[model samples]
Target: MNLAESLGDCEFQSVNTAYDENMPVDRKVLVDNATLSGVERLIGESRVRNLGNVDNDILCLEKLLTAILFSDALMAIDDYKEEYRSKRSRQFSFIKFLKLDHVSYADLSGKAADFARSMTFSFDGSKPAGDVVSFFEALRIDPQLRWDVFVSSEYLTMSLLVRDTRDVGYENSIDGVFRNESANADVVLAGIKFDAPVSMEHHAEISSIKDLVDAFASNNPNFRGSSSGSLLARCIFGYGWAAERSYFYNAVAAQNNASVFLAPLRDAFCEGCCRLESRSQVESLLAALKSKSQATMAKIVESSGQAKFALKLPFFSAYLISICDNPRQCIEHALELRNRSEFRDCRSILHNLDFLSVGERSAELNRILGLLEQSCDSLLRKYGVATANGLQVSLSLGLAGISAGTSIKLDRLFPFYRNRPFSRLFRNIAQDMVNVERLGGLYEKLCASVKEHQDAGYPSRTSVTPKFMERRENEYGRPAKL
Candidate 1:
């Protein structure tokens, strides 16, 4: 009843795929082209290698099924709960739908059928054929195939991991891999809180694995502190957003703290071509974040990690600024600033500034913050910063943003550092400073609060933005306040 036995050579039936012709006009061209290309690649790769590993082939097939299920579930969520629709949100819902421990093989078979029937493929202009049709047919006719095979030791472990992860948060169930009697205290600790019921029953100390993962996930923006299933899905599918992968790997490195079962899990789940690249970038950012002095932040802002991790990676820079012994305060601070009214007016402008970091011209940047702060001197006192480090970090971040050409991001780390309205105003003033000689007048103008700029009808500058931000403008994507 093993996977290899279940997948023994079997005949496959071919079927026609029917696609919806009336897709949204704007998306039709791109979606169709991408789908066609994807199918060709999926089938071509599987068919060519006579020596293809059956287990590997099964994994690839699982990815394809997961993709179809993911897409279908997302559409359902969009229709049912429009407000709670995001790639991450949909993914969360999809895991709930899976109910991995309860889902039957028959359900998987039905899903496979639906996916196969929906996809139409063609080679050299021949009649269109669906890849899933052939794939499922092979499984359908295999005499050795049985639903019970999934419960075999290896798959049962994976199932338990997914099932427990979906029900309890990741921190609670992380050590499920070491749930067996033979697993040591470190392995048990990796999966459960030291004070958790099971951990207490065994009288284990706070596991280092737990500390490492908690810290890494807390600081890494991609994992978003607690929403971990997306990374789990990525580990299965072989590719994921760079941020998610980065944070997930950081958690993995922490598991390396417990050298027992972690290495094997890392090899199995974290195996993709991008592994080395992502690990390097993640480590670099972590090192920068961990440094006690501003030297780390300054160095990162001056290098590749600055744009990729600090600016482009969502919330990561804020996490680094907020790094402390306890992250609850930092998380709360980020959430509060995100929702504050002061930054509400120029949120998009603030976002634009994150992507526009100017590396070398720091003196000009300070001038920008100084000019903008001049107008908001009264509010600065009233804003009431919580800590000295918070204020210092915010000010440094403001300078960092100016050097990069945007300072709105400082709001996330230091709520009172740079007034958003003033940030927009200062950026306008900087943009208007065309002549070196006229810089004096521009600084004088920027010194006025943002209200003065608005009253005087100063023009705001618009910069090109990333595509992901553009997608955020869709009906379901309300700009994040937190």
Candidate 2:
């Protein structure tokens, strides 16, 4: 049995919440207390705003019921075959978990019963008290969840996003929010790529997102990037190590003081009610706000896309508004959009469909390629990238992930620029800086070779990656040692 169950002796029920006797009621749950977020915030929303259509709510509830997973705990025990991710920390007990797309509840009957109970709450948009109980019980007995505990400090993959605090908070998934230290912990996830939040002056890219997130997760000692990120975001999310809300005690900007606004945010909260008078106090207030905000966010998620799409522009824009303000919202938006049959359409037809008649396919591909060339010309002029002797190089490269030389002539008008397509391929791979530089630098020499086809087009053609050449040489006897 998991440690959470070992402490208690009663038979665990999936649909009934057994209140923890260790939990104190008179004391505030946020101030120097264990952060307990109820699954109700996510599962209990339909009763209050029965205002929305039941069809959509039913769909979303079903989606969330099966989709959400706690990967960290499953991995630590090492018995669960399900994919798992965890966080490394200074606070000792803080952990984060992620459930990927492949896993699901092996016992569907219990899950459906629990979710049905959660949907029948009293609040207009209530929390799922019963749902939390079910989740904990199910996790305790599930073969994957009941695996052995981890002896080493190795954390999970995507779940590296948790705080490093141990004294005041413990990682509890049934609560619907992760609890970790706020003092100085940092949690980061690698490999999950994201584009920067859209902004002016700074061109945000996916690699930049990965790097920034890694820096926060690594908590400085493990982080190796040169850039600095918004410290407030990390602290707000309780991803910092050694820093609890109490650390804000000495700062005038104590997050709870309610009087410490910088004029702009002065009106965000009532005067003196949300001021941060000290560092520890600031931590306390922010931690509280984050706790509350977590619930509100879950509520919003429950009501997500419940309304019908009457007007396309306003509907899409409003949906994007929710997503733009928060990263989780962004993910949910993408998921929702994917489920909509209405928005799917053919984006462009330029790639190879070799089985079709060559003449007709060639004509269609050429027409599409022509349009791309025109667009590239415009982008270069607008973005202030001067077009030299050839066409706008970047845009012509266009759609990513096909082999690098698939469209060599699309970006270059010169019959002599045979290697241009290869160059464009590398440049189009936004996250791939290495190949882009290597390809960009070799373009001129390749172009010259293209012009003097007899002088050494062979070397230009042969100058591919060593990895590919290795495979090729394995087949065709190591070609004259380059």
Candidate 3:
């Protein structure tokens, strides 16, 4: 069904921001033909309208247009399947910022279908290739900081470009898109605010989006060692938990590295990916791994009868290196892991495990910790990453919880990300992230006070002030001098 049709019969429920003067009107955006088509038309006319008027404002508009398109594409995909949305949120912590949880699954499905259809109807098979300013025009939006939403539209469009389109202009248009983005560097950076305590611009290694994109795109073997290290740091500093990110990164590294650091680790991870029986088992595995006890591990696995997917290696290493100091336990654990996988390099990971001196093992553990520490340092210097929690909450750095202990539970986090990765009708998370970063300790103090009040038998109070005067009141609580 079309957007109008889908929205006409919408059964979704949401907190209305229209009456909240403090909230911008854009936060209450509705995905109807008028709104979507207006943006489409705006982008369409920008090329001709901005022929000779190339300026900072116009460039910012172009980036904003791209951001809008990118966010739309992401939202469309979230609508298509719940998994994609959850995976991205877990990876990027986008849900914390975007508030995808408030939306209904049914609403997502309908809107996703409309976005898919619109892509087909609007641009056709050809790229919307135009001049320098073809993608945007100089116009201040109600909420200017919602540029992250705008950029998300690009990924959906890019996926189509990569998969569906065979147009001759695709390559040229894609190049043009990047070129324009590069030209509008100020505009792009403006949209992405890094307000963490550290300075990202000062870091030489990963100072910009170009750097991140380049690392993700690199193919050189020489770069693998450094690139993997950087990626690992990004995952840790940017995200909250280490389960899925560890699995993804380890799998990627195993594909390239011939030398296996730990035997049965990769195999166990792979097996877990293929054979895991239930979410409960996954939860058990997370708890057992965190416990870092051999007996605990065996008991959990045996009781659950779960597959090897539940035995992730990085978690094992984290404990083995950090907390667990028993040689006998380490040997027993390695033997248990060995009993499952037949990888020839398993010996490399497990052989002579029982014989190593404490100093040697400690040295190895120290090395691992050093790598992690270096990575964390890099993120702080390069991306302004604060604590893993701060990054997750403030920057949407993908801090998905593996267990219920840290971050959000996988079950809840996943579904929200899957269905509503980006929202057209919710609060702007990007703005929120900035405020959280800017406020820092003050933000935490404010939250604590609010919680304290709630716990002390305070109930919600309805506003007595007029809607139009609320913004002014918030800014001016004092009596007027006049």
Candidate 4:
């Protein structure tokens, strides 16, 4: 008979099912001898039920009965296994109730065993609120069903399952089964090479940055000759202390063949160090620098990007010389050396130094400033300096005021100066500066006010007097001063 007909003929009688005390008792008791026999008959029939022909109520009854019977079968298989283990029973009660012969029982046992095991393992003494195990069992039973869903969902399920079973002994078995059934099994399995644990013997041998870089390059050959490789190399070198000065030098020198990669390597090293901002790292770098000979130190300072890294930090230049035996000699030596003839590089270093000295100044600051200034002067002399993008560089004279002529000259020379406004505003400033008479009168007024303040007998400078007066009278007469 069809599933609906069989379900329609069944009579369900309330029967109490034994459950662990810890298990929830919210489930309705809907299964009995008559209902179980009806389900068995429905399973035995191979005929497919036509939902269009079947009544909706009978179809619903069929679905409800099927679900209840499936859940009961899952729980019974788990109980039978436990009972068989303890008592060595020759026959399971559910097996006899279903009237399954040897072959049928073996087939049913194999089909339902995994779900039973997973439910028992996951829930332990209590039943789970939902049958998560059955859902996974459906996926295992039907390959086409897994293919219909998004691949990422499968990966998410695998991750969640792994996390849930991490401390359990059966995680590996579950992981192996899921991976074997996954659509991307080849890709997932290939990643195992990278995830393999590093051997202690090999790990112990990575005593220097060079050793670490070599090991990485050996394993990830595809990443070689790429910017990513350079970045990785820089991180290795920058984040750790070297075993010796030679080791550090050799690591830097090895990348000379791909000099184009050096810029990013240097930049990343500097950035990594700055981001860490660790006092211990700073001290380590300083100690490394101090141990080297003057010639070796100069190579590192001038050629290997260490000088730029050190200058990026606040007051590090001052700090470096502070710990030196001869501060004056060190300053003089640094000043005498010539930097690489790159205008942009010189400009960047000078800007960093200026930013560091803001809000405070010292003799050391002046000395460092002189060293960079001398390098810049030397660069300009050698290259015959030109305006950066046709704009003049603006100069700040502290006591001496910025004149209109100076502004015009700066606009002409350093058109690319950061302070230069957009084209429209720049044109307005240039036009205003050209009106020399107006600007001159304003300047004269400013000078007159300054002279008046200096001549006043008040203890402090005051722009306003204590009493108000008519403009004409105030201009001509000496008003009451504060």
Candidate 5:
């Protein structure tokens, strides 16, 4: 049948040929041409267009064909037949064509047919070349692509490069795609190289900080005991959950020298404290504190407390509670002591914890709090804090009490001191009482500072309101006194 007649029903109809013994036809050529024609027709129907750039089109088409063939081969694999059947069905409309340079349609179709034939025949148990085998094997084993047929265009392009090239290591492949100048520095540093085309859904999943950490931890083998681990440490230290970063650093430190992370840890701690506008940020600072030595924690606290924009008292309380031998026990002991005196000062600490509790209780906030709580619990247990029954005490109460006490002390001693340095304020609070120490030396300093500040005839910075209209008038030639 003619091409039009063969495809008249919108399905691939078998072409029948009449053969003459006297004049033998090249049946293979005819069949190939017929298949090419069918593909062209489909491409046309799908509205696949190419730009007028031949070189770019050729390159893109080669990658697209390779990806399509690889997907088909994977579906044909006996081991994954059942698993991929539904996936294949779902991917019927998944192949999207970006505008490629205009190349000869015949040349592109011929190349695609050749690729399809090569891929189809290669599944006969014959060992392929090392590069091709590794290229396919890496993709074949990717758990992320197992149940999805959707492949990212970039991944396909990378796969084609790997298949054609030799000596392309994982890092090299990653570097080639995500170059140093690329905006996705986090992905590169975290070693998140995609061997296979992952679905957009999976791409979105790994885009998150938490998932990125998990991916970094689970996927990159080169990160373990390698200098790359430190690079990853630096990268993660800039973004995501501080606790996760600390945990990763601790793990890397375990393998490498702990001293390696000390400098970075100090820097990260100070930077983290400066940006502590949320409970999660506070929790991250606490995690950093928990990971380091008592001396390191003290140094960080002291240095940060001396800054003009010192850590908030409530957050500082959380930090102190985190560093204590047993935060829960410390609070319980303090509460017991308070009870004996018939005076309850733990209210401020509780109030502080309540303030630190997630403001909106959103899912993301809940997740952050959950991770922070777990990290805090682990830190508390590390300090030998357990219940009488040998179970671990929940840190919720300890954290609350610490926060409350810190807030109360700040309110009482440094009521007018907006920038109440954590170090200064914390020192004036009795460790045993978990409340303000009226006789402490720091208390006298705070009293004098408050009195001096009051006498300076300066308005409270909080109470100062900008005169917008007056400023506008001054800017545009001040209005007459009238």
Candidate 6:
């Protein structure tokens, strides 16, 4: 954020001159992206030319806060690395001016100062690497804050980034700003972590700040201890839910000295080739694999690439049988595809639990039957025949979401459209096709039309076929047609 904006937001005096005038500005840091660069050019030139240096002031505050943040991260790393490289302890320094009228560290005392002291522990004896962020994140997981203690309403908002192993406390106040405790610098940043690691049985836990804290403190050891760092990192790599997981990804990689953080991403660069019929399709899939739930997709990939391919044999066969409809082959495919675990949802199985023995056969039948029932319901619902009232409306929605020009039930279509309602058509043809007797030709005709239309593009989509309607007044044995 620029100066004027932060001042207006924090309700503080807008301008204060720092004599650090000529230290070749950290060009890369200042000009992060085009937007930040623009802010710099506009603000810097303004301050130099004395045209109301608004942006410069906010940016400076942001810079200072970023310093603090760097200090925190470096300290955490130092704790983990234990390299005693720098002698200066990265303690947060207060702005000389936020010192007016007991504003600086002086204004803070008694309960408030004690509370703040009690709030954060200055790097517990253990390495902060994963533990410190977890502590701050524990503070952040309060799904919400009822900050009656805060002087300004702006402090009300805060977010926590928690991975099983790595985490951080981020404030999204008036402007985009994040602070690393040790650096005492303000970074107008977006995120911290970037890529997640690949591992089995990894899951991210997203909950309210209160819930997060509760989980960390109560029962969810993964959120509290350093042990959680790797687990949380793995989950963050998967689908870390709180805020955006991407923000914490890079930050965690840069700071936390844990088990190789970006090993999966590097490994992918080394060995991420996926062979598929469509190269473009595979590339796109691989791209998605980066952000997808890695563990779940891994299961699918493992099954797909297996030597025997037994795990997915059932689904493959079922898919082929759906298109071909060769009953014998479909049965064989269905048998191979079926898994008892897959049919635990079938109400039929739940009902006949005692009589029908549980096995692949039962699961297979239930799977097909379950699919059939669902498909029928889906088709019926699509055609607006979901309810009894809709049933009489006839089939306006056809085979593949198409609509016949006109619709009529079976009895109406046969003799009506052909000028020979089924009442008459049946009398003439019932003697011929024995199959039609068992399932009347009119019924047979309906089924045939349904199948044909399903395949065709009006009632057939690609083809135009006349829809049937009921007719009367002239036919052999026309049974007093209505």
lDDT of 5 by residue, 245-315 (tens): 22222223222211111111122322332232233443454445334433112112121222111111221
Best by the TM-score measure: 1
Clashes of each: 6, 53, 23, 7, 8, 70
Instruction: Give a tens-digit lDDT track for model 4, residues 1-482.
Output: 32113223221011001111233222111121212211222222212122111111111122222222212121111212232222312221222121235554444333222212222111111111122222223112110100001222210001121222224222222222222112111221111111101111225654443443355446532323222111222212211211111122222222221000111112222222222333344334434433432211111122211122121111111221233333223223333322222322333333333233223223333333334433333332332212222211111001001111223312222223223111000001111112211222222221221212223331111012122221113322221100
Quantify how close model 2 is to the true structure by its C-alpha RMSD in Å.
Answer: 31.6
lDDT, residue 280, candidate 4: 46
Error of 5 at 470 (Å): 48
Q: For model 1, how does the per-residue alpha-carbon lDDT over 134-235 read when each residue is reduced to its tens digit? A: 211211110110011212211000111122223332212122211211111222111111121101112133223244234334543433332222122211
lDDT of each: 0.22, 0.20, 0.23, 0.22, 0.22, 0.20
Where is model 6 more than 4 Å wrong at Cα? 1-30, 34-41, 44-482
Residues 1-482 of candidate 2 have per-residue lDDT tens digits of: 32224223332222113123233212100111111111111123112221111112212222221121100011111112222112112111322222322232222223322222222111011111221222222112110100011232221111111223231111121111212222111222111221212111121321232433453345423223321212222212321111112121111111111111011011111111112112233234333423442111010001211100000001121223222443224324544543321121001111221111223333333333333333222222322211222221221011211121222211111112222111111011111111112233222221221112122211101011122232233431222110
TM-scores for all predictions: 0.21, 0.17, 0.17, 0.16, 0.16, 0.14
Off by over 4 Å in 3: 1-373, 383-482
Using lDDT as the yardstick, the better of models 2 and 5 is 5
Error of 6 at 362 (Å): 75
After TM-score superposition, the amount by which residue 73's alpha carbon in candidate 2 deviates from its true location, in angstroms, is 29
Q: What's model 4's overall lDDT?
A: 0.22
Better of 1 and 6 by TM-score: 1
Higher-scoring candidate on lDDT, 4 or 6: 4
Candidate with the larger TM-score of 1 and 2 = 1
Model 6 alpha-carbon miss at residue 204, Å: 9.1
For residue 12, model 5's alpha carbon misses the true position, in angstroms, by 92
